[model samples]
Target: MKQMQIYAFDMNCVSHINHGMWTHPRDTSLQYTDLDYWVDFARTAERGKLDGIFLADVVGVYDVYKGSAAPVIETGAQIPVNDPLMPISAMAYATRHLGFGVTANTTYEAPYLLARRMSTLDHLTKGRIGWNIVTGYLDSAARAMGFEKLPEHDARYDAAEEYLEILYKLWEGSWDDDAVLADRARAIFADASKVRAVRHNGTYYKMEGIHLAQPSPQRTPLLFQAGSSARGQDFAARHAECVFIATPNPQAARPIVGALRCKAEAFGRGANALRVLGLITIVVGRSEKEARDKLEDYRRHASVEASLAHYSASTGVDFSKYSLDEPIEQRSTNANQSALAAITKEASKPVTLRGIIDQMVLGSRMRPIVGSAEQVADRLAEWVSDAGVDGFNLARTVAPESLRDFVDLVVPVLQERRLFKADYAEGPLRQKLFGGRGRLPSSHPAAAFRT
Candidate 1:
């Protein structure tokens, strides 16, 4: 079996995808404000020989449920979040070979500004940065940014397509490879003629300028996207080098992965060019009983209200409006349409409020693996073989504790079986993952814009 890539799935907040797990006695997520927390995390990931840490983010609060923010704020449901990009530099400084995949929505941010920020980080981290492109899904985010409501779902992806064109022009085409001429006699840091301006006038954006910064190590940061809708999947097919997906089971994930690969091939990309990673949470211990006990202990801290608030925001449905046994009626709203669609359309069975709560019992709908290290590794291998997934984005149940358990217990077993890396690879995140050059491959659509 091929070695699997693992990223420490997380967010820069008191609570992330798991919702109310911050109250867990062992969770240190509340220390998100402290720089040391991130630094320590980076070190721990490196020690585990993990590929990277994927940090999820949102620009605004979750105010879709009850049409207000109080539920989110009161339960700490991603409301007290810090900027995802803030702690990354410190984390990079603390560890070598640990990539950072940080999420930033393209809807509200200017392309040039975001490009510069990513380039700066690429330079600082020596090309270990990956950007998870997201179109803002929250109506609250739109309102906060002065819009009446969020743009239609497909329209956002359309806008993102144009956004990527502009970014690619800046990142890959504006400056020639040999543009930088650091010669004292010439007194020229860069040859201006070698750098050209990028001009674009599209339905969503218009820009006429050269790239603001000199090219970093990797001209373009590693491209990642998490969109499971038809339009979203199409967008990922065109531009995403890595794709994130979430499903209730590996059986469910298999067809989605197949469809995504087919879509990528339809867009003239290699079927295997894009790597699909599934979100999963595991609670492994020396024995199955210990793992179950740990899960129960963690459940004592799970906040039902917080989980509901998170679900409400993500699906644009207010769980507070429904009783526990109510069958969740599917309706369109202005949040993560794909997520909502998955629960409603794709599921083999109907999803109910109780079902949702049960799913969140261990943080999201990902199947949990419990038992010894060998048992956990065997399950992961089975998922890889059966689902055709590239790897797993392991979510933390309790802060560093969940991560620590995986590293100390499961990693050794995986390494022993030769299913994971025992040492860091010498390159940027892309090279580390793909075992090729650090930049986007020439076959990628973004590479077509290169000068």
Candidate 2:
């Protein structure tokens, strides 16, 4: 029996992965800027024994809908978004075992700055930090960064490869584990000889400096990536300890999971090197009727147009151009190719605009599991046994209430079956998730840079 893990999916905005659920009268996402709301949310997830809280972020607004940002703005698709990294320290302070996996794109920011920012969070959280590596999928983000258009998709991944190499050198090679002496008698703060500058003149980046910060509890934060495309999977196989897979069903997930593991083995990282977490949304209740009714209630707040607007931005195809019944064709996109694949060849059949709308029952295309606690637990176990997923990345439907329900209703059922952790294991996020080891395994590519 494999143990299943869970992470709460969210963002620092009103609407995250779910399109327009912010309209739900009970949703507290409107208070995204409020610290009290975040602290409480973090505390709730910790109480639920969730593995972590993974924050989704985007640097630019969703403007692909009708070639205007109006619908996204009106529905608050993902606009009014704040930096995802800002709330981690506060959230970490409010909880003990919960981890934070923050999304940051490699295309927009300098690696030096990102490496340090992540290190600072790792220090603050005492090593309960993971980085969700992404390459920007929106052209609007490119414009915000002063580019005429987004870089070619594969080219972006190419740059990311170099970026990670530099990060490894800085985080793993620049400082020795015993470099921090903090000895007052000899007035020595750190051993100078144990630290050295990292020099890299790669095609995409050039830097020659010692790491800005000393090594935190985990010299490198646990690496996470969610790219289901061929090029993306190759990068993930080499770098990510955990991979996020978004599919409509367990049948769609098994091959992706198996391939990722096989690719990791090909890279000499061993077959179990990568842990695949499927994207799932749960709407649980004390009774089956209660869950069904709750799902209908949430459906009433769903906005198909808002979902289309978000989909347009994600796949870089304007839904406004296609008729409701028109079939969508596969085209080359610099945006999220995997998202497009999910509805096209990757799906059981071709999906059209109407099909897309029909799928947005919970404000998005992700299939939701609605049932009593026992039923939800059984389905989760089935996913683990059948889909070959190590865990789940739970999308948020309604704010605190959705999370609160899972904690109060579903967690006990999973624990009772011994499929979920009742108590958190003691250590940094990496150790808790992968075992008692507090650092990256020697088989990981980043370990090659270690001193």
Candidate 3:
């Protein structure tokens, strides 16, 4: 039996994937700006022996729903968001083993600058950091950046390939592992001859500079990608150490998981090279009835309008124009093709305005698992076996409350069943997760850049 890897999925805002849940009396997402909140979150995750805390981010507002950002602002749906990178150092200081997988969009960032920032964080976190690489889909972000429109869906992925290649050169190639000598006897701080400047003259970018920072514990932080699109999966296959997927259920997850692994195999990566995590939300209680009751309580605060607003920006379609019974049309867009497909073309049934609302059971497409500790554990085990996923990026429901319950109740059941580790492994995140060296494997594409 393979032990499952779990990450606490959250965002630095009131409403993340589960929109409108901030209104719940128990929810304290408003404290997102406070460093203590993230520090506490990191501590709790470490206590639960979770693999990491995945912090998601969006560079733009959800204004596509009704031709305005009012609905999103009124409902507090992923708007008023903060930078995910800010709280990381404080959180890293508070926890020992809990990794931090921070989402950063390559669509807007400069490769050299981003590489330096990640390397700095990697040094500070002592190698318990991972990058969730993303090519953003928000037109609002593009407009704010002075672009008339975002690059086409496949075009963005195309640039991302070049972007990551430059990052590999900066992180892995520029600095030799032993560039820092610190030779006090010889009065020399570093071997300048060992460090080389990275030169990239690619289709998307041009750079000729040395990496600002020295090699950290894991020079290239663990790469995590969540591109469910076809081209996206191809990108993940080549570079992603961990792949995140948001599907309706275990059945929906299997094929996507298989596709990514198959693509990875074609790239000459080993079978276990990529760890795929399906997104899920769990509502745990001491009794089955208690969980159901909690589910009802949570649902009462959920806002469908907020979900629509968020979805509009995601799929590049305004849901306000559609009638209740009208079938939503899926068209080619520069936005998240995978997100739109999940509710439209790929759905088991023809999705309508009403169907869209119904599918958002708790203000999210990710339906929650309501059960006792034993039941939650059972569902998780079944997902791993039936879906063929490594584990889940458990969506945060009632903030620290749901996570607290999971660690206290569900973790024990999982450990008893031999489905989860009772203790964490030693070393950097990559080694802890894969049980080997703390850096990219020799077969990995990034390794080719190494000196």
Clash totals in order: 0, 0, 0
- Residue pair clashes in candidate 1: none
Whole-model alpha-carbon lDDT for candidate 3: 0.91
Candidate 3 has a TM-score of 0.99
List model 3 lDDT by residue over 1-451, tens digit each: 7999999999999889888888888887889889898888889899999999999999988889989999999998988999999999999999888999999999999899999999999999999999999999988999988889989889999999999999999999998988899999999988999999999897899999999999999999999999998999999999999999988789989999999989999999976899999899999999999999999999998899998898889899999999999998878778899988887788878889888888888898678888999999999999999999999998987887888989899998999999999999999999999878899999899999999
Tens digits of per-residue lDDT for model 1 on 91-137? 99888899999999999999989999999999999999999999988
Clashing residue pairs found in predicted model 2: none
lDDT of each: 0.87, 0.91, 0.91
Which model, 1 or 3, shows the larger TM-score? Answer: 3
lDDT per residue for candidate 2 within 175-255, as digits (tens), equals 999999999999999999999999999899999999999999998999999999999999999999999999888988899
- State candidate 2's TM-score: 0.98
**Candidate 1 structure lDDT:** 0.87
* Per-prediction TM-score to the true structure, in the order listed: 0.97, 0.98, 0.99
